[model samples]
Target: MKKLLSILSFGVIAFSCQQQTAEETNAPSVSEESLKAHIHVLSSDDFQGRKPFTEGEIKTVNYLADQFKSYGLEPGNGDSYSQEVPMVELTAMPSETMTISGGSEDVVLNVLDDFVAYTERVVEETSLNASELVFAGYGVVAPEYGWNDYEGLDVKGKTVIVLVNDPGFASGDSTFFKGETMTYYGRWTYKFEEAARQGAAGCLIIHETVPAGYPWLVVRNSWSGASLYLDQSGENFQPDVLGWITRDAAIRIFEASGQDMKNYGEMSRSVDFKPFSLGLNATVTVKNKIKRDQSKNVIAKITGTERPDEYVIYSAHWDHLGIGQEIDGDSIYNGAHDNASGTATMLGIAEAMSKMKTKPKRTVVFLAVTAEEQGLLGSKHYAQNPIYPPSQTVANINMDGITAWGPMKDLTVVGYGQSELEDIAEDVAQTQGRYIIPDPDPGKGYFFRSDHFQFAKVGIPALYASGSYEHMTKGVDYIDSLNQIYLNTQYHRPQDEYDPSYWTFDGMALDGNLLMEVGLRVANSEDWPAWKDGSEFKSIRENSMK
Candidate 1:
């Protein structure tokens, strides 16, 4: 018996030694040249902005597939690296006429400036004629919070007018619902989803640039295009009609009702907030042309040597504003920093992992999702219908809106406290002589906007760290100014086109390296990362593990 025990112990030791040797040999390293090269191709004008459902998407997917093949990545879906994502494109034509009523004075809402409306259903035309308008305050119905904006109100045939952000924002008390941090409740997606659940004929969210963190022009451009949605196999959560009313337009409606819009907006921030009865009504006639279209989720897999069933996913959205109305002379909304940097980094990581001699213990999935700028649709589809079982999936590392200004002394983890993945990132960051910082503006709810949210919703812990505001070389003020300049002048605009003269890709290389290190730590770990305590995803992930 002792002899047999000795032999067993010896076998285990030998196997352990072999595993360590393999890991040491196969660890991936990010190369400066590779990072710059990938970004150059992805941000190139020839790609036409990488908008999905167009010829641009075709080229973009093929380019990724070809790169993955060269990097020795196995096909993510059976024999193909592409996953077909069925989508419906609904285009709401510019409204010819719109009106407001139920007020002491008659009010006419102007198109382009006042409101933007679109149909959720796949229809050629849907009209909201003299629809009853209800002041649905925050438009939220969180049973946990004992809040219901639709309480005792039958909004079946009515257009619900809701406030932007959560009541906490208006309340200004951190004790009330996540303080200034925008909860999922503050998200526009949630507003429309909740409105649909309440059976509203139409949903209109009042837009405040500060709360929305984006201008009305963003809505105009995004909604003006052929809005795409996943062809939900069955009944999905979508409102009958969804739209946004400018703050000024909302004020006009309130003024017509002989009420101050500013005062009502102020009341919306209170905890005991109730839907206001804005003695005002509205009528919308939406003329939309719906068409079925198809897009692809570009996927590539770096097969594991031992734990092939377990996986780590790195993702970024590839689609952007295709060709929008010209801002100046340029028309293509070249989403360079918005996501071109992200997609490029994803490709960069794939290259590094492919060059490694030793394969990771777990499979590494690289996904370049589409239509994130739309509403996180591409990643959402993948989460609902993943190619791999969610149980074996370990974590997701996402990249979006990478910095082009310069490298930072710290890495900002958006949704910083949401997951255990942050610890892994910190360890990696430490190795690079950097540290991790919480999101500078949690009130923005930026954590919920990107593709990572889709995975997080389905129980996969995801990381969203990027270069920070504190530049490694220059001061914070310089970096802030440059970033502000980008936001005001180029971000999401045609001017976002690549400018080699201005962009210092060496900074991108540093970011790509840090991200690559984070992925490596997860790929080699036997334990799966978890959402932090109190995170909504924590319970979901725990259940999924079961």
Candidate 2:
């Protein structure tokens, strides 16, 4: 009888082990209800459009925390599911006025119609009066590439105006700056940062709708609202005035400097390109008031079984254009595809993984960041002040503006040619009977604009994949038209609301599965993914790994 009891116990143990193994290998199926439910709640009117500082933020963050708790995810930040990202929300509304003087004749560039400007320095009172202006060519500093735009120039007490993209982008030459693919040097954020480092009182970027990827109206709409930034604790960070000037205004300035706008634009692409002081001068006067407020970055994590110290992070921004000035009587900019879908998808993935009978070998952090619409600020904060050390974090899987259309035959990696993450992505895609495709417009610079960039800057291999419209059920042409319509009319506007009828979430599930596979492969492996050869981030990752 004792022998019989032992045999039964052994049988039970074997069965349980097999079950656990199956659970670990099998992919979890996501539900439509799960996706819709989360997104609906997040984009609902009661959430007040999920703006960071308003009651909207409170409702949205609490909902995210409750959902994380329900999924059995551990609090990501020391017994708390939410990280209180202390931010000073500033709203600057300046009356339109800017004056410019140069040459024998004085030129005054009007605000709103000609240019847009704002200040990062939190001051009760500020003004820009007759500030000397310097034109910085493609405002970039890449020591590795032996390029410097501010060579031996003191920009203090002066306003620096910069061209839009990198030299390679402007030059249409592959050998110049990463070619059409924009380096971080091409990003507006980098331009502002370089100017700040140079002690420039203010920095202004020339805006071309094609290179900047949106119209000046889009810029105005975005900057008109409240801007959020991580509040500085000490005196190390210096804030400066940041703004943009229209292409026509830029052309006028170039003409005033006795240079043809077309010739200068072409000249900027050459390796011999040097920062020249545009003989024209620019002056602007601004008035603004500042207010301080706070926001939250909702975070949750599932600890690993073997390597809990190491992590895989999945992130999406949760905030969007909330309660914009009414356009055609529609006030709420319900950012359904802009990021509610991405945020909801992250939670869905978290829920699916958390329900598995066996835990992963590495921790998975689901981060729903704030103010990506404002300029990747929340991700910037998390990257600099990470909950887990960046070196231990394997990679960042980021989703921004996921497709609402149905399934397709391909996946689009924003920065396709940059790193080895594309290889892993392709391997996963093959399993789904899909393939990987590069962004059609490398010149558009979608890679630098997303939240994944923050992680990439800190030497983490990051993946920014979204659904493709090439083979949707409605046909490629229809799918393409739909996306173009969204881009033309709805992007960053009040019309970005949920449309249950047209938005087939079939691709959402597929995208989620691909993300799951990528994380699983990274989580279970002993190896770390690295950027490819000649990539700027490759050396950094190698050093961090060592």
Candidate 3:
């Protein structure tokens, strides 16, 4: 059973700090009972995995609105606590005959087992009628690096097969890109976007377990179901087809096309490579079960006493994979750690702030968005259609998956060195007797994985940070193993159900306080925070502010 956060009165928070003096700043006091209550209720079996376009979403959104009202906040969307995000969900049913035939080869790759594909265009039907295939190396065209895979090639209306990750990652060259650490160019999203910009009829990334990070099972589980995309409103440049093919299946397909993975894979890592035809004609006829609906983004705000227009936003995604493919007799993807924890953690901070004696000078928003699991669609929609101007928003502090393990001595900032937020974070962490560290695995490209990236794309400074590295009992090694185990077994699986048996509340509280402190400092100060000088977002920020 889940316990409730210690409310001062029924439906009202009583725990408010008078001032952030030296003593108060040294420790954070987020209620464990409060955190547990939010998590258990949100992740309960009755919620139907908290998926959108279902009963689960209804309960989740209504509950969040009620919570926001109870916490004495104003509805963020003018008089409504909810913002309707329009989306076009497509469930592509790939035929068995979807194949690449040419070079005397007849290869019919099985769906899910060998590849996964979908369309980005807002259409019920999409087809690739034997589109000519081109091997476009890594599909990158970075002018800064003087690298162009499609240097002399015109791939218009042709299907392009690209390698995952950038050249530096493939070659392990320290001087190239960011060495083993993946750059924005290495992400599969970048690959697909680039292909579409290059006028490709279809874009398929060849997936290798190591370079792609997760195994093929992850891809199948994530992309197999009803895929959601922002209604393009008839926008072009998004490819007719976007997908991934497994490494083993890629090897077989390459050999049939009179090539081999070793030769092409090596060639992709070199900057001297040029795009060439694969001698194969790729074909796919997609039948989409289309659904159009609006997902809810539960938003409310604690209006600032003075500068309400200048806002500080707190975000947490509230959507997860609904009922789908069964695994070991379980069907619902609970998403307990993936985001229920994050939602709860954000709520705890809101509750704590509600009872404070002094509100910040700038406004603070509590936004629990939907369809994040569906490719950050909800946040993407919000960024594109923001309630307030992006320039007025000081920062977006996104919490996605708060560490439920025991206490730690360090905080792990995902995008560690991109902004001055890290500097502020370092200052706040020191008082709590915790050091700040970058994500140990930068090669995974986690910085671009969460909803914060959406806000960052629009020039808003965003922060996604977590803790539980140096455990109060065991050390860093122990914490690392626990994270690995969670990813391998429970992440995005039905097994992610809430289990308080061995869960720790102090970690969540501490992380929550750290986030609150970061926001509190930003909200209270007259000085605005910004992206660091050499950061990619620096110019974007400069332009937006101007």
Best by TM-score: 3
Q: Judged by lDDT against the true structure, how good is candidate 2?
A: 0.79
TM-score (all chains, Cα) for each model: 0.93, 0.91, 0.94
Could you give candidate 3's per-residue lDDT for residues 325-439 as a string of tens digits? 8988999988899899999999998888887777878999999999999888889999999998899999999999998886667888887888888888888877666689998
Q: In what order do the candidates fall by lDDT, top score first?
A: 3, 1, 2
Give stretches of model 1 more than 4 Å off.
1-28, 233-237
Candidate 2 residues 141-254, lDDT tens each? 889778888887778878888888787775656877778887788888888888888888888899888777787878778776467767774543443467888888877777
State model 3's lDDT.
0.84
RMSD of 1: 8.6
Q: Which candidate would rank higher by lDDT, 1 or 2?
A: 1
Clashing pairs in 3: 5-34
Whole-model lDDT values for every prediction = 0.80, 0.79, 0.84
TM-score of model 2 vs. true structure = 0.91
Residue 281 local lDDT, model 1 = 69
Worst 10 residues of 3 by lDDT: 10-19
Model 3 spans with C-alpha error above 4 angstroms: 1-28
Cand. 1 Cα-lDDT: 0.80
